[model samples]
Target: MSNQVCAPALAIRRCCSDDVHHMLPLMRQLRYPTTPSVLKERLTMLEGHEQLCSLVAEVDGVVVGTIFLKQHQTHDMMKPVTSITALVVDEKHRGTGIGKRLLLEAETWGKERGSSQMFVSVAGDNNITSKSFYEYSGFTCTGYRLSKPLA
Candidate 1:
C-alpha cells in the first residue's frame, strides 16, 4: 500500500528501517516484549516478505501508531486470511481516528492480498478495551480464543 494522508495532520504509510528506533518504544508502550535487537530482527524479516504488512501512522512526522499484519493460507479456508498481529495507537492519539484509518487500510491490504477474512485477537478474556473498537468496526464475536500452556 501507498502512503495516504487521512487528515491535515495525519499520514499513514509502510514502516521502514528508519522507523525502527521510533517503533520499538511504541511497542514497549503497549507492553510488547521486545528489545532493540529483537525488534530489528523482526523488522528485517518483514523486509521483502510477501506475506507481511506493517504500517505506521504519523502525525506531522512523529510516529504515533503502528500495526503489523500477516497474510497466509489455511487448510480450513480456501482464500488467504490476514491476521492483525499487533495494532497500537498512542494513548494520546486514541479516539482521533488513527486506529480506524489503520483498520480500513488493513482491510484494503487484505483484499489486495486475496484474503477472504481479516482476523485479530485481543490478549485476554477480561480485556474489553479493544473489543468495542473491533465490534464497532464490524467484527463479530464468532467464538472465544482458548489457550493453555503445556510447559
Candidate 2:
C-alpha cells in the first residue's frame, strides 16, 4: 500500500449509523471488505449490543482509523474485561496519533464500564509493527493463540 496520508485534522467519536458510509472504505483498507448495506446492518447490531463499541477516527470527514472493542466476562476475573476485536489504521495515516487516540477511547470506555483488564489477540504471523505498537501502548505478552483448520 502507498503512504498517501489524508490531512491531519482528527475527530474521534462513537460511530453513528450514518458513519457507515465513511467507514466502509476504511474497512476495505483493513482488508475486510464489505458493502455499505451490510456495514450499516452490522453497525446497527453493534449499536444495540452493550458488549460492543465501534469507534472511528476521521480526518476532514474521512475515516483513518477504527477500533472495535468488546466487553468480556470470565469466571477467573470478577470484573469485566475489555477485548479489542479489531484495530486498524489506514496505511496513509500510520505514525500519526490517530490509532492511539482511537485505542484510548476504547480503553476509557472499558474503564468507565467496570473493566478490570483489557487485551487484544494478535496473530503470530502478523506484522511486527502492529505487535510493537501494542507493546509500546502498554500491552504485555500473556500467551500464544493456537489455531488449526478443520476439514
Candidate 3:
C-alpha cells in the first residue's frame, strides 16, 4: 500500500489587508524587511491602483506564496507590459509548484489586462536559482538593468 500523504489544496486569491501578518515572513525571504504596519500601508497603496495585481497562495488556508504584478506602458513600448515586482514562496514550499502557479496566475491577469509582454527583474548575479526559474518559465535575457543609488 502507498504511504504517501495527499498534498493540501492550494487557493490563489487577491491579497487582503488581513494577509499582512502572513506575508511578512514571505517578504523577508525576498530580502524586503519591514514592520507589519509598513507592509500593510504599502499593500493598501498598491490595492488602490487598478493596474496592480497582488495575489496570494494559500495551502489549507495558510498563506504560503505571493506575487505582485504591475501593468504599465512606456514611451518606447507600444503596448502595455506586465512586470512581476515580487514573487516568493515559503521556504518549506519552494519545490512544490506554488511559485509556478503564482506566476501562471499573474500571466493570466496580465493577458486579461491587454498587456503584450511580461517582465521581471532579477537582482544580484549570484541569484542563479531565481534567474534559472524565470528562464525556465520562458523569460529570456533581454538586457541589463543598470541602477545607481541616489541620496
Positional deviation of 145 in candidate 2, in angstroms? 1.4
Per-candidate TM vs. native? 0.89, 0.86, 0.92
Candidate 3 residue lDDT tens string, 1-151:
9999997999999997888999999988888979999999988877758898799999999999999999999889888999999899999999898988999999999999899999999986436899899998889988887899998
Task: Please state every model's RMSD to the true fold in angstroms.
Answer: 5.5, 5.5, 2.1
Alpha carbon lDDT of each predicted model: 0.88, 0.86, 0.91
Stretches of candidate 2 off by over 4 Å are: 1-7, 148-151
Rate residue 91 of model 1 by lDDT: 82
Taking the tens digit of each residue's C-alpha lDDT, what string does model 1 give over 75-119?
A: 999999999998999888899999999999989889998999999
In Å, residue 94's CA in model 1 sits off its true spot by 0.4
Native-referenced Cα lDDT, model 1: 0.88
Pairs clashing within candidate 3: none
RMSD of candidate 1 to the truth, in angstroms, is 5.5
lDDT of 2: 0.86
lDDT of 1 at 32: 79
Greater-lDDT candidate between 1 and 2 = 1
